[model samples]
Target: MRKSVLLFVTFVLFGLLSSAQQTKISEFDLYGCWVLENKKRPSTNIVTYKLCENVAHEDVKFGSKISLLAFNESEHESTGPLACFTTFTEKGTWEFDENSRIASLYSGHEWLKEFKQLDPDEYASWGSPEKFDKLKFRVISIENNQLTVEIIPKQYGKKRTEDSLE
Candidate 1:
């Protein structure tokens, strides 16, 4: 029991340290819930990607001196004739670099494949084997209540709004 408690405390401290290293997002105005618009259908030459219904719901909160950002993605609907493909749902903190306009997202302190619950043959197309622990984004623009970010690795565009609509 003592070991577990110490490990948990260490893990939490690591998260805080990393978050402190990056530029604080409080300088900007991303402090609200922004729902992703449009269905994302990503594909590669070898594997086909399926639409994960009810995709992403992101939230950005602020403290007196610190900021918090969290994103959760889920709702993997099985498509007909495709009994395979890994489910990619990640949730964690986000770090931003205002100078480079880059936002790096960090998943849980540690990644466990077993936590994903997948078949031996099934492979995740999106945020799978890679653990998506540090997904980066190049901020194209964020002004006047508009957010346009291009995800790295493939540069997929994602636009969000404050009105809850596309």
Candidate 2:
């Protein structure tokens, strides 16, 4: 009986230790710059995503529903003078769930609430149940600390071809 109890306790402790390997969201881990890896929009080229410090928000809504911790708008800058290039500070909050392989982005002010995330190697948004008006993205490559993202429209046809992206 004593040996069985000791073995059970040891197993439980081992399980807990291994589970801790999964990473949780941290401010420092999110502080770095993330380039646009979406391949759909190539003209704008690259974007610098910086997580600003000493910023806060309150009572933020996720998607059309749900609530989450508040995060502030960070700086967004264009790479060059391309007509497609434009930059603006994103007003929202971001969270990363490593185990789920997902990153959640919540935005839209008090009225137009919407939240979305991209799982690892996935380009689909799992927010709304609607089929149309859904935005998806694909990552082409990451080189020299730059990311190229490809946008996949919900509708695919001659009207929205790759060449039309130009």
Per-model TM against the reference: 0.35, 0.29
- Tens-place lDDT per residue, model 2, 1-166, is 9999999999999999998755353333444444322224335533322122211222211111112233533322323346554333434444544443333444443223232233322323433321222223343433344333344444544356678644
The lDDT leader among the candidates is: 1
- Model 1: per-residue Cα lDDT over 1-166, one tens digit each: 9999999999999999998665433324444434334444245222111111323323211110112343422111122345343233344456666777665655443344554555434545433554443555566655444455566653335534456322
TM-score winner: 1
Roughly what TM-score does model 2 have, to 2 decimal places?
Answer: 0.29
What TM-score does prediction 1 earn? 0.35
Report the C-alpha displacement of residue 31, candidate 2, in angstroms.
2.0
- Give each model's whole-structure lDDT: 0.44, 0.38
In candidate 1, which residue pairs get closer than 3 Å at backbone N, Cα or C atoms, i.e. clash?
none
